[model samples]
Target: MKRRHFAEGAVVAALAQAVAVPAHAQTRPGGAGWVTSWAASVHGPYPVGNPSAQPEQRFLFPSPPDGARDQTLRLVLRPSVWGRRARLRFSNAFGTAPLVLDGVHAGLQLGSATLVAGTNRPVSFAGTGSVTIPPGGQAWSDPVELPFAAEPASPLLAGRKLAVSFHVAGTSGPMTWHAKALQTSYGTAPGAGARGAEEGEDAFPFSTASWFFLDALDMEAPAGTPVVLCLGDSITDGTASTMNGDDRWPDVLARRLNAAVPNRVAVVNAGIGGNQVVGPAEYGPGKPFPGGPSALARLERDVISLSGVTTVVWLEGTNDFSRNGNASLEAVRDGMVEGVKRIRAGVPGVRVVGATVTSALGSSSAAHGHQGQDENRKALNTFIRDGGLFDAVVDFDRATLDPGSGGLRPEMIPESTTGGPGDKLHPNRAGYLAMGSSIDPAAVLPVRR
Candidate 1:
């Protein structure tokens, strides 16, 4: 919204001069060009797991006949960049017991739960086809060659989707998952064992909006390739966007970058719906929040430790101002400062960009739209913009706000997920397109050494 008082003059003036840079101009640290092409921030388990912005009925998975044993998960993921080889990472971070996985496969996705004919290839861990991850832990599979991308930056790889299929070996007590996938991932009936290698959707009939176990996907790319990590809440997580639409702001940014810089940069999203920049001090398998952990809590796992993370675009903090959060603007700013410090410490020379929080003054949600919440949000945005806390800033507030209403733009109100009137909190696909396009690619590019 055009609040002359709220929009810090410095931020407005700075955003006017932001520009886009050539991908080749940015330098990549670490000789290994292993950038994360895809990622889903692990929240908790499914079926009454973490609270999510998505409709509850969408995650209504059929009861496991044998309690999560011998089942297969056919996950569909769209990588932001192309590569000839890829590695898979699975999480048991919330499981009460160990998670055993076997019969892992990755191939070009043809459609729902189906892979392109004869394209499925086996995946392994430490040279073995199976891997066991202990409770509260994670595992990364060995790299498997992608048969299609024989040449780097192939035109065939554009807008390509991958179907990663894997089977759970035994009982998994509370699966670890990214609760709001917003994409349809398939699963097999309980006791339906090891169907990952089959490449057929017949064995899988159940549908879930959450991604189980599988989280990060890293691709081998050319040296100096930049991986732009988008870290934030539902806006960054693609809420209100169509199911499997791949139209989240980060996704839009990724598509633009892929078209503009081709093989030079990868955009990975680590946004959790309902996420906050701070507060909710307690979190884990037992104590869960739909938003997962606070931004400060997840900075290490979601941003710092990620592979090839040369730059981070943080777009969060709306939740921190929610009544439930009741976080002070100073607290939120401190959290952002700490998060930036941690990211810099963990990944030296990484670029951290801050995004202005969009207006939620007229949100339907009760937790928001209270007196002073807007002030806190604006103050935080001002700190983000003019406090010298970030390498650069993206004015998302200006991009999505309605000057008169102090809410989402009129055209961005309809929910893109179900094609209905929206709650006016989360922006629709069209709004995301605007926010994505608003981001100056140059602002997110790694700083010159």
Candidate 2:
């Protein structure tokens, strides 16, 4: 075997001594194991969805069809929880051809595209440096130890972001991507070739506010570390919140959980901008929609298939009531009911919490602000609070609604992302903080023994 393969095999063997199971195995009964620390639900192929604050990509990816050719992309993301061993998952769920990736590395971000010294580590797949994922497929990397994260609960590591670098070996036809990353990531010009091994920013000349191919990051944590997934639309996806500030409602909730439990729990966001509980009845690469897929359609891949999820906080349905969707109130309600049943069946003993839909009574967007939309939203909120379908309920509607105006609170109207009088639909940073703080941590997490 090649020396590189031998080294990877040794790493796997060392991990087996601690895990006793394959790297893909998520939970291990009563022992510390893998838990999803960060995740982004991919919607569709490139340039087909809503992207916030996106820069022109003509230079880096001149042709969307050809997609990343011999280029390196360094994606930066924050993990809610830290651990010594980490693994990554890359998706081709929306690709039309095989996605060939190689020269992968993971390290601590040191601003822009540079990585912290002595922290970058090679990532492999089944003891190989590369992997080819067929269309509509995904692959997970072998476990690699994070030397900087030896103390998983270290305060110094809290809020730190991880930089994952990878090279697209050939033309990646129609790359599967999460459009609204809202966090800056660096990429090299097309044909740059194998720059993933570099630790400097010079090789990476361009930047993007989106994430491509890579989707989920898993970390070994104490057994039974509850992972609370916030699944919703733009609000849950941090639409109007500050960019790169990590002040989304889900981010705020993670901070709250960290303070109370101190790395004992993880919160991951699986929200897609413009996503709905129902509508767009069918979706795929051929019939791509900006919202990607419906909540019921993506539940398995976004929620059930993730690692060590113990609770799911479902907050959606606003988009379904939008003029673009015009779905009936009953249809959305039934979708949620069915979606909950599927979650229960897929992950036994998982708690599903329903968050009431916030008001879009006078949204600035052309697709929303209709009286009919607000009516349906109010009706859905009632059902979510009293429907008895969810294990628990979080009243996000009440948290942001202004009783007098029947719209978003006055203070929540100013946008925090790009700075403007905010859209009446999504809340600003202050509003997100209110929504995040409203959740009782005890409701989402089990009491410490």
Candidate 3:
């Protein structure tokens, strides 16, 4: 839906042209066209606590420490649905310090679905496996630059995973994974692992947003193929998804699309934990406990211009409702409006699918969640669901809340999913799954030929 017109001709024309638009601008005004978000894929941060990262939790874990010495994680995944070649993304978007790793290998599955898949091929970063990720920054593997591909493999990753066994010279910290990292890893002190490390470890972290920056794991469609990006806060990051499980709804959804659909879509998870949509206040841009920087500050850089990004699945603002933001409903809503406007300006006609702020009411967390927070969420949801502002809406608020309790469902949210109710603010893997499932395929683009 278009915004209500208030400006006149030239000004409106300039505004229209200014958004970070795809190169295929019609070269004429008021003509006919919709910028298709081609080669767009969806994904999210998988959360996990690494025993090596947290020694206290080490014994509770079953695997050996990875990356502690310079480990390698190998993922063996074969795309069931193929298309033009695609680029791969590795993230360190949230690290507080520098990141380093060696040897990233990507290849077709060999004898088995295991990393031991015999006779597999090697994938390179830009061209080499070794790379560095600056604090709070991200990088992408050089495009595989292969030919258009397809699959008879009915299943997207039918028994496929990654084999990332590298040598760690240095790091910001221990690797914590959410959604159980999709690859097998080992750590050998820098310069270690001359050949490769063991594929299996005792356990792996299923971290949501902190996918340890990333190793060579993505299969990018050619520049013009279809892909979508999901960008936002903890919710979008798969915070509560299973460790090394890759079950975040978006992950789930990606597998679904790649497996059964003809669009050959991919999903990229750009969710940052504790991200906010209104100010630079979150990521400590200015003060302590500052939440992640506001969405506005980084939207143009992270979302609008991402490679192969066509459609953006945007969800955020729950942090705004918290006391930390101290933002009024009116002010926050206006902030969202502005964020959306800025986005349209950058990627002209790029579809923005907005997910309403879910309920934080009745959170068991003694910290906050008063009636006020709940009310604000409801108000924000109303504005978002009201079509004209966003091209589409995904009302997850209507999904996780218990119809009876009006909070997270007590049943669907057992101790495991709800984190045993300690601080009801964040859910466990199960809860994250519930939230992820709330995404409706209809809200995103339908299967387009």
Leading candidate by lDDT:
2
Error of 3 at 248 (Å): 2.6
TM agreement with the true structure for every prediction: 0.90, 0.93, 0.68
State how far residue 98 of model 1 sits from its true place (Å): 0.4
C-alpha lDDT score of every prediction, in listed order: 0.79, 0.87, 0.49
Give candidate 1's whole-model lDDT: 0.79
Off by over 4 Å in 1: 1-32, 48-67
- Clash number for candidate 1: 1
* Candidate 2 per-residue C-alpha lDDT over 148-200 given as tens digits, one digit per residue, 9 for 90 to 100: 99999989999999999999998999989999888999999999999888888
Q: Tell me model 2's lDDT, rounded to 2 decimals.
A: 0.87
State the lDDT of candidate 3 residue by residue for 1-449, as single tens digits: 11122223422232233334335332223331222221111222212221112122232222323323343444333332343244455555544446675655444433232344342334456668667877445666554433213442334434344343334454335332332233223333332343343333333222112234442233433333344677776666554444445665566556544434443455666565556677544442123232345777767556765544556788887777776666788878888888888877887656688887766667665534678888887878888888478778876666666666666655434333214443445455555566555554445542222
Question: Model 1, residue 135: what's the lDDT?
Answer: 86
Per-residue C-alpha lDDT of model 1 across residues 227-255, encoded as one tens digit per residue: 78999888888888888888999987777
- Per-residue lDDT for 12 in model 3? 29
Candidate order by decreasing TM-score: 2, 1, 3
